[model samples]
Target: MKRRDFLAGTAATGTVLASGLATQASAAEPLKVGFIYLGVPGDGGWTYEHEQARLKMVKHFGNKIETKVIQNVPEGADAERSITQLCLAGCKLIFTTSFGYMDPTINVAKKFPNVKFEMCTGYKDAPNVSNYGGRFYQGRAVIGNIAGHMTKTNKIGYIATFPIPEVVRGINSAFLYARKVNPKAEMKVVWVNTWFDPPKEADAAQALIDSGVDVLMQHTDSTAAMAKAKDAGILAFGQDSDMMQYAPKPRISSIMDNWAPYYIQRAQDVMDGKWTAKDSWLGIDTGIVQVGEISSAVPAAVKADAMALHDRIKAGTEHVFTGPLNKQDGSAWLKAGETASDGALLGMNFYVEGMTGKLPS
Candidate 1:
């Protein structure tokens, strides 16, 4: 069911009761599961993927579980209230699917020790709270290679959502791979500061196109940039979802986050009373970070090379953050043959060498 419809129906019927209470009336009642979404599933990006996984999970356990979702829940105090409502409404497991919900998830988990909480793209945990994210840089390297080989103007545009480590890591990974394949390729980044704002994303894409960028990439969660790139007759990559409707012209490829396996496993764990607080950061190697099909617009040779890189990364034969690399100031980071550690990547704050402009403070 669509989140909006479910919410409206629940509000109209006023049936927000705890599961434990329902179980008293009928011991066969299904376990109550809940989700907090930063945006509606219709956004067709981040939340859409989560919503798909949620449906898959529900189907996997059919009559064994029931789900309640609250859409468009912002971070901070509002997130806390939404989470608390889920707990009060009898959700045995709750997934807070956004980085900004880290603190709020942790805070609410403290009050509901019996409830299991999972935070996506966050770095915090409690006895009842666990964190999980994808190593999307692996997929970024592949798309970056495509961008490098395809950009006629040698300028690639990136629509960024925020200056957080996740976004920064994507930019660095994409730029490094792009430069590796095409020495003349330069990345031009524009921060829109919001994840799901289509208008802002479109503006950023237009600005980049006006500045001579022929290839567009985005870390934001909308098709706005792709639409803008299409209108300008430029090549682009999709984010989070397949978004193949504009393929063969603008969207030559895409990076997808496959959350089904992880979601199913966590739900099963909760059902078996084996759920634990642990961190899971999966990548292309585990099928969590996936590369969508390369469109026919890409030259056969370029597509082959991109897929070869993808296989190498998945096989652990290549590391995206290998050095000799430097920070934006030309200071040495990883020496030749040395690779980046998870610690460094998680706290990455500076731009890599060859990148222009300051990272937002």
Candidate 2:
């Protein structure tokens, strides 16, 4: 969706960050930045968060920058065509915002070697391309702590979008935090398999609740999951963006993907002739991944505790994946004080101990 608030902001287009040369430490050059989105910008979740970052980049650079965005872009052939079109149209710094666009991004980047590429939420990194994302798992930790205290059944339901590491890691993060407060707490995940389908997501939420989950969560994009929770009078955490508005009656808190600042910073690096390929995986400390207002559905005292926990994470005094953990198979996954690393986090393939569900093939 087009954002009206971005009326005066600058946007990225074309190719690499200050890709034209940057032979001199300082050069006054205008840059065109290109952005690709997997869904309509107004889907109100995943795509919206990225657009916010685009608008901020616009505002940050002003006249020296221009942006070209192609929304509702599909992942396959359409992606190759879009990248070609943007490159032909003169985008020197291209940022493809979805994981599916990864190879198309590399394909185009190879053809337009002069252009720099940055793929959000993707793993492939070329000399001209880098990846960036946040520690969404950290937000999951905050929600898990609340779930442990709020659930009457000690059964927390998660409506997961995929078996990809991102979704799996979030499940583990929430489970990690919950077990600390309630040792018997268990997480049950229902994978909807797609990121943006509302009907399937709603069905997943209903199925979980039917199985006796008192608290719910989701990694899917639409508001259907929350709506389902509200209808059933179950508590649930929000996702991607602050989805509280959709299910005010049941929304307990939200894991917000705040992407604006990173966008601005990356684009500014281009403007200032300091752009380079680097992986930026930021978290609560950088104000990138955030959990918004613990709802009144959560008791005030518990809210205080959650915030305290949040602060500890921010200060690096606490890590969500610390040792002394177990997999769902009853095997030890971590020793106390032994935290899982980025490598393991990125390729997580198992469920933690106590989660009742099967991973989809």
Candidate 3:
């Protein structure tokens, strides 16, 4: 859900001085940074990627910064409490890493205006809060291209976490690019709703395989889908992070969400007292989102083709949501040669043509 508009003006220098927060400095005390997560750091996908970046931040800042993490914090009221506790624990900067934590992050930020809040996969921003996320759909297009060429059954399955626009966009991008290369390819979706349930994600993977799917993709934050595909003798792509450790067979490639560079920069910004609220949606060009290793299981030609598409997207010559596109209901959404606007894409709640299954309400 969208929240209040971002505060308009910059924080006056006098505001910081008047608050006396700018004077809190000590050579011995490290600037405290806090991170709140939707799942455990060992989930091996979304949360895992963010945790890796957190580790990177620690390495980059060394003794200059001290970090704290609270894991498995559910969205809504629970998140607000977790964030509040973090602020009370002497954390000067906090990062809430999940889309569902949007409202909670904003609400908590209000009570601690001097504390900086960074939210991942959210659209809202306040004077002390910033929104940042990667364009995951860009990487989806590349993996979908590989899935199109490698699938022997021509049926691709998508294991989804929720019906949010972020998830929907990935589904649409994969379907559009998959069908582009293999006209006979059809996408089948199974929504598990929850983001990091290993059992539920595994069940969904098996269900999709039972439905004759020989290639699998997932929006959930676990390697269960990849493991299931490996056991089923099918192909799959990793979500959020590389799963090539399970590769050479079922896991042919992956969509990697790289947060290290951005995380490091934001930490530096806070240290330099230059951090401000702004929305950041970066992708392959900025190394925020990337395509992971393509295993030897994929044919060389298909790998090359996928990389070419990835390059075009990175160069801005190709758009995943570009036109001659239509909604799932056969309604024209974009005319030929037209590209989707950021507003439309951010609020997308409908599926594109050729994708099967209803978007959850």
> Which candidate has the highest lDDT of all?
1
Instruction: Name the lDDT of candidate 1.
Output: 0.89
lDDT values, one for every candidate: 0.89, 0.82, 0.86
What is the per-residue lDDT of model 3 for residues 22-61, given as tens digits with 9 covering 90 to 100?
A: 3453444788999998898788888998899888667655
The positional error of residue 168 in candidate 2, measured at the CA in angstroms, is: 0.5
Comparing 1 with 3 on lDDT, the higher-scoring candidate is 1
- Listed in order, each prediction's TM-score against the native is 0.92, 0.89, 0.92
Give the candidates in order of TM-score, highest first: 1, 3, 2
lDDT of 1 by residue, 1-361 (tens): 1233533443333223324335543556677999999999998889999999888777655567899999999988999999999999999999999999999999999999999999999987699988899999899999999999999899999998889999999999999999999999999999998998888888999999999999999988999999989999999998998898889779999999878778877876876579999999998987778898999999999999999999999999999999999999999999999999998998899889999888997
Model 1 lDDT at residue 300: 98
Candidate 3 has what TM-score?
Answer: 0.92
Q: Worst ten-residue run, lDDT, model 2?
A: 1-10
Estimate, for each residue in 1-361, the C-alpha lDDT of model 2 and write its tens digit: 1122322232333124334534432355578999999887777789988888787767655556789999988889999999889999988888898878988998888888878888877888788888988899998999999999888898999888778888889988898789889888988877776889888888899999999999998888888888889899999887888886954558888888877767777777766668898988888887788888877667789999999999999899998888788887899988988988988898898888777777664
- In order of lDDT, best first, we have 1, 3, 2
